[model samples]
Target: MPGGLRHLGEGTAAALARELKEELGLDTDQLPEPPVLRWVQDQTTTRPGSTEPFERLHLIHTLNVPDSIRSRIATTEQDANDTTQVVWVPLAQAAALHLYPAIGSVLTTPAGTSIGPVELPPMVDGTYRWR
Candidate 1:
């Protein structure tokens, strides 16, 4: 997924569109509406190899992509500043990977577990720590 905070006065959908184009070279005009906010985690973190502390708000959205677009996406092309690697992991082996917000419960929850939104736990740290 694209990263970076929203620009001044920009809405979520617009920021996502711009970030998609700039970071992943994806076109959002042909895609569906803005994604549903699946989870939000607030964290106090520190940069790698640095002692500075900062607050980070993580927003995970669930966007359904059509098979046509999904098929065209052969691989995730990263931008110069993006360090994330996108790969497909089988649901059975998903736990082996390092994932943030610890989505194990979310993955294991049965379908129709609830009708409305699902909110995950938040992270707080006394000192600087990077995930």
Candidate 2:
């Protein structure tokens, strides 16, 4: 689930490796190349302190980590003002949660399926199940 904006002159695989290294403390050799892209989300939102709309492109990739690091991954990550919690829930359980892109169950789709352009309305209830 480690993700970040792609750096200039870097491909997606390299960017993914960078994010995984920075966020999960994993080295490139520990990770396989060419992650499987699961989805591409076209997200639009209003950032804090701004009324104008902001657009972002999300590339969702599925990576399988060895058991060595799967359960040992840090659950909490601290930054300036945000804390990211990592958890591995069953796909069905995760689908039931109110997730952005609403990628319910598609995560279990067979390989080679290109799920893309996932869009949805803003949640007025301010409720989100982020993992």
Candidate 3:
């Protein structure tokens, strides 16, 4: 999913739209509906070179990109960070990768189906589990 943190005073949809266009050459009109805020998670993390631990809130939203748009997507993506390969892995096979806000239970749902708006239990060892 094309994702990014919301800028100060910017709403979620705006941030996501910006990321999608910047990263995948897509726009907000391609979305089926307003993105769903599936869950909010807080994980304590240290910066790349810092020793200080800070709380980071991850707002996980589901972007329902239509098959038409998805089909036209390129095999690679770029962001402010760097260019990266886009691997299309089936949801059933996602368990093999380390996904943050760990898409734990939702991995079992059919692709394109949204997960929960439910509160997930606190993460164990900094890994977000959806159960």
Candidate 4:
């Protein structure tokens, strides 16, 4: 996932889609719509030496990779501001690994604020829901 300071006035899904387009150079139309949104709050010291509080909403989406283009993904830096390299991990393996302790806790409690946990409803069969 790409990480950077986000500008105000933009919604989370729009910001994530823009980031993917700018950072991966992939056609937005080819990407799947986000099915879930997970909000996280973080406090950090900025480059200008000021404490800043920010909320990150993780937009989760799955993409179907065609065999032809699979090997060519992640070949370039489409966004200059992007600082992290993207990697693809198999879903089954990812779920089996022991991730950071905080990662698991985030789903149970809101971070850095008093907000409560955001529960995502399960999807029903055959419906297109995009955010």
The numbered model that scores best in TM-score is: 3
Clashing pairs in 2: none
The deviation in Å at residue 3 for candidate 3 is: 2.3
Whose lDDT is higher: candidate 1's or candidate 2's?
A: 2
Off by over 4 Å in 1: 81-85, 101-105, 108-116, 125-131
Please report the candidate that would top lDDT against the real structure.
3
Model 4 C-alpha lDDT per residue in residues 69-131, reported as the tens digit of each score: 556656556666544565666655554544321233244332334343343332221221222
TM-score (all chains, Cα) for each model: 0.69, 0.69, 0.74, 0.44
Question: Per-residue CA lDDT of candidate 2, range 1-131, in tens?
Answer: 45678888998888887787777666656654446666766666655667776666777777767778676666665321376777778776777765665456465566655455343343222432233
Residue clash pairs of candidate 1 = none
Local accuracy by lDDT, each model: 0.62, 0.63, 0.66, 0.45
lDDT of model number 4:
0.45
- Across 14-70, the per-residue lDDT of candidate 3 in tens digits comes to 887777777877776867787777767666655456667656566776666678878
Kindly provide the TM-score of model 2 when superposed on the true structure, using C-alpha atoms. Answer: 0.69
Candidate 1 lDDT tens digits, 1-131: 34667999998778877776666666777677656666666777665776776677776555566767766653664565445555655555675444664554465454446665576666555422345
lDDT rank order: 3, 2, 1, 4
Q: Which residue pairs in candidate 3 collide?
A: none
Off by over 4 Å in 2: 32-34, 78-81, 112-131
